[model samples]
Target: MYKDVNNGELRKGDVGKSITVAGWVSRRRDHGNLIFIDLRDRSGLLQVVFNPKISSSAHKNAQMLRGEWVIQVSGDVVQRIKGSENPDLPTGDIELSADKLVVISRSKTPPFEVDDDLNIDDLTRLKYRFIDLRRPKMQALLKLRHDVTRTIWNYLSNQGFIQVETPILIKSTPEGARDYLVPSRLHKGQFYALPQSPQQLKQMLMVSGVERYFQIAHCFRDEDLRADRQPEHTQLDLEMSFVHQEDVVNLVEALFSTIVKEVRPTNSLSEPFIRISYDEAMERFGTDKPDVRFGLELNSITDIVSNLGINVFNKTLESGGTIRSLVLPGCGYFVRKQTDELIELAKSNGGKGLVFISIDNEINSIEKLSYENYRSPIKKLLSVEAVKSISNVTNAKPGDLIVIVADDYKVANNVLSNLRTEMGKRLKLYDTSEFSFVWVDNFPLFEWDDKESAWSAMHHVFSAPKQEDLEYLETDPGKVRAELYDLVCNGHEIGSGSIRIHDRRTQTRVFNVIGYTKKDIDERFRHLLDAFDYGAPPHGGMGLGLDRLIMILGGEDNIREVIAFPKTQAASDPLFDAPSFLGKSQIDELGILFKPTD
Candidate 1:
């Protein structure tokens, strides 16, 4: 055996015991005669010492070792002298006295050092991912992901869920994102798409009477990428038959709470996550997924600012736009440069402009405030009555900064949401270690797709509309609400789910509203539609983003930190050089042709 004990397993108790350990050189230092090396493995790091007095040959071989050289050492563990032990390391109390050394492998200088705190570019780290994963932080994240998956499996299995392995290749269907298609070499002009979420298959399991089904699913998409997205990702996909939206939500809430208790004991999580309607969330926070830890809630001053004669506000109201404001406490002293920067921020987020009114000194009442107490670009345009009404509505006080945006409803809300998030960070308004989870519910069943001049399902076509609103499917599709809900944490939507349409009639209605013709429905979802005929039970579930969940748990801002080998933001794999052009011979076998490009 190459190793009898791991590098980090040795301690003061194991002193005077002989053992063999294998690891890579983490650090090496040569003091005149004696040499010291920090050996690292999956467990942790251990300090190994080579002395000429103990073994001349081992001491000679250790001199040649450099960073990241893999080797095996037969050694006796000895306690480090008092005050010489490293308090930061777990195995620092004992040192390995090498009697023999064998160089198993050697490594060339890496593109970047395997250090957790090192600042390395994304491309460089990804191109050499093998070395990148050697860092302690990366290793811990990999372990955390594994632990999360294991916990999910155990919890679901205990709840009577059958772990089913769904097919990787599936029939192409419109599941929101674009599909990653693979050519079928044996069948010309045919291609198989990677499953986006096992969405349809899991529902089929209900038809087969599985009752409860789960899978750690690998999903693919050809969509644009971001810090939280990748070309391919994994999800905790689960579906339960004979369930309502509440049933799914309760199960998931319990499962996640248990995981947090067992895995992240230090972080605080609120029990019985706060629930808010989609409309209310947007009205108060200007976002469906809001970070509820802070209180920069958006307030509309559209009515109060009407006829105020500020050109921007007056024109916005005339065009059916709204005026929204966010009050930042104690930011009344902002200078012109700072306020200009904020205006730029608002413009960047699609707002026409930003207006700031700061109250510089303490005032007993809004009526008492005049030009002396206010600082604003349009202070001269607003009458005392109008300004007082705005202050009363927004609850603006002395030493507060009122930032307003006059634009379309969507743009105004969106711009204020971005500014609220930024200011929350600047003010340290919330504890970073706290996980605030909320359920954003009551999303519209369908949204108007102006670009396509048609209606599109807001979440997906399969989502069941509220029974009371189902009558509007034909007459007023926009008025229908679905049983859709999103699980948000720390301002990110980590999971989404809804009660699904299990019958062909309701499913067809949704499909029709989304501009799908009979032929298109038959060609796309005929298999799923047919399955509903054979006693398909009502089912609903969620595909929890495993990557995003772990990212939040691990306190990482990017999902890539939790993923072992994630593609770049541009959706290209730097390590494998994926999305490359296909070889001519391979393309020929697949019966494919390419158009020449300039």
Candidate 2:
């Protein structure tokens, strides 16, 4: 170690002690005869002063140094002059009086400033991630991520969970997201897929009598990218035998609550996180992962408009549709142009258009026609009584604007849901400091795949069907629910898990229900089925996206900030320029062929 005394630890108490320190030059200020240099290392920064009277050679060498030059100095710690002390830094009260200086390495000026407050594009930052990581903000985030991982490891270890290493190469199953495949050298026309979540392997581990297992595993999926998503990501994958939905939920709640308290003491977490069924969430918030930070919830107004003569409402109800609306507080003064833009926003999200109605300031009675200020063309078709009834259902008050969507159930809900989220941002209704966690349970086991012309697993095929809905698996697949749970915080899904089917018979039944033939099931998951024969215990597991969790903890909108070597949205690394072409001999040995097309 190059001088163990950290920059931050050198304080007034060590004023008279001689010490050696090593770090990069953060800044250098020369005042004719005296020079002050701020030295920075991972721990922190400290100010070092050298005067020609103390050591003429050292002072001359320090004057020639530039920013980011790695150097070593032998010095005596001394308190700074009272008037010159800086309170912002931990070691601000002390200064190192250097007698000797040794330049260990020289560095060229960086393309971008390595300061925390510097504003640089993500592409440029990623290209020079090595230097970027030197900044205080990135260093803190990386350290916090490490602490979170360690917390999970310690917590699981104490709970009797064994850390198990799962294979990176596995067989690809035809379900869920697209797979990232690797060519197999020994077998022609065969490929090995990267593990998506260690889902199958964890389940098999439980079947093999590994009662509890966990892994900080890397998962790969060849899917379209988003700000929070990556082609490859890390998950705290864990599984436990003889566990049910409640058990899994309890374990997760304990772990997360503990993590929040230790890792982010300032953040407030909801004790016993709110539980809402999938249907309830869709009904109230219009989305499975609902952000509970505000109260502008969607309310059904279908009953009020079913018999109203409004063309928008009548035509929608006639075609098997429903009407829903969200009332924005104190937005009645929005100009015509603003209303039109909101209407277009709703249309873009699959609605015919939005009906903007404002409460009239003068009249407050249901029978008064003068009490309605409407922006939609269909307003003339609605009577005073219909407007009052709709307003009553939405709890609208004077100066409150009600935006309505009338169309198919899914379309109306989705359109208004997006509007609610967007309007919240425009209205400044979201509280960034507040964290609202909710558990969305009772999800549909299968969803109809339009392109495939069959039903597919909503979570996964192995997720067990709810006990009460088992009889409806074949008779009424749509009514059946799965034992699935999602831990959502502020509109993002941070983690998800489910009680899995440990019995081979139940597993096969699920595969069949999803249109998987026996041959296909046997070929894809034969190893898992074979393991269950000896005596498989009922098991379940959940995987938390580590990068996403760190992003949330760091108050960052993108996961790239928390990830050390994150790939871009295109899934390419700019720093190393990866995914490049390989030699033909290497491809040939992997039993692969490449053909270029013009």
Candidate 3:
């Protein structure tokens, strides 16, 4: 090891003791007779001073140091001057007085600076991820991720959960997302798909009587990318035998609560996470993953809007659609431009437009009281009674702006859901001081697939239907709910799972409901069904997206910030330049060909 002392390990107790530190030079300053260099390692940064009288050669070498130059220095720990101390740093009170310096590796000028809170282009940062990880902020993020994961491992291990490793190469199964298939070189025309979540293998563990199993598993999905998603990601996959839905939920809730309190003491998590049905969550927050930290709950004003005699509202009602709205307090003073911008926002989200009713009592109010009157672009289309009903339904106040969307059920909720988040951000309504975990329970088993002209699993085909709803599986499949649950925090779905269909008969029925023929089921899932023949325990579990959880805990908007080597939104690795072309011979070995469209 080149380093005997980490830069962050220096303290007042070590004063006057010589130590060797190895790291990259973060910053350099020359004061003629004396030079100061900030040396950074993965641990942290420490200031190193070089005096010509101490060692002329070392002082000269220090003067040559520039940003991000790798070097090792032997120095004595000394207290920094009280006036020059950096209060923000943990080792602010100590500095290294160098007597020897060695340049291990010198670096050219970097494409971007290595520091905290840089606003560098994402592509540039990703292209030079190696240097990017050298930043203190990135280091701290990765460290936090490691610590959180460690906490989970310790907690689960103490609870008799055996850590297990599942296969990376798995057979392709329909699981909502496209699969990234790996072509087999030896087995001609055959391929293995990367495991999406270890969903089935973990169940297999339960059937083999592992009792409790856990793994930090890698999952792949050949799908469109988003800020929080990637083609390949990681999850904390857990499973238990003879456990019901409540057992799984309680275990995960307790485990994650412990992780948050231990790994991130700066933030507090609410005790006893609240659980609500999926329908209730959507009804209240316009999303199944409700952020209960703030109250911008969605309201059904379609009943009120339908009676207003407005062409838009009546037309939507006649078409079996609905209306929804939310109230933002003290936003009635918003100017026309601000309201128009919101309209465009809604339109972009597939709504016809946004209806903003500004109840600015100062300028427009008769009684200077609740729903006295309102100033809005569509005020002419609304009667006084209709306006009063809207205000009452949405609980709009004198200074509140009522945002209404009239469209199909899904569209209205989707538009208002996005608007709610945007408004929360604009009003600074999020309480970031604590984590608010919620359990959204019992999602519908299947959703209509217009393109496929069939029903598709809402969670997955493996999820067991609620026992009471089993009778409605074939007749009222859309109404049949699964024994599924999602763990959400700060408006992000952190984890999800369900009771698995263990028996072959029930599994076959579920596959049938999802429009899969017996041949289709046998071809894809026969391995799992065969395992159940001997004996399968009542098993279920959830997989939490480790990257997403880490990103949230690190207070980052993008998961890539916490990930050391992450792909860009385009699903490309800028650093490695992956997804490159394969040689013709290699392609021929797989017996594949590329064709161009005319």
Model 3 over residues 418-533: C-alpha lDDT tens digits?
Answer: 88888888899978777999999989999998898899999888999999999998899999999899999999999999988899999999898877888898899998999999
Per TM-score, the best of the predicted structures is 1
Q: Which number leads on lDDT?
A: 1
Ranking by TM-score: 1, 2, 3
Clashing pairs in 1: none
The residue ranges of model 1 lying beyond 4 angstroms of the native Cα positions read: 362-368
Please identify model 2 stretches exceeding 4 Å from their true place. Answer: 360-369, 372-376
| Global lDDT scores for all candidate models | 0.91, 0.87, 0.87
How many backbone collisions does model 3 have? 0
Tell me the number of clashing residue pairs for each predicted model. Answer: 0, 0, 0
In candidate 1, what are the lDDT values of residues 463-503, reduced to their tens digit?
99999999999999999999999999999899999999999
Model 1 lDDT at residue 402: 94
Give the winner by lDDT: 1 or 2: 1
TM-score against truth, every candidate: 0.97, 0.96, 0.96
TM-score of 3: 0.96
The Cα error of candidate 1 at residue 117, in Å, is: 0.5
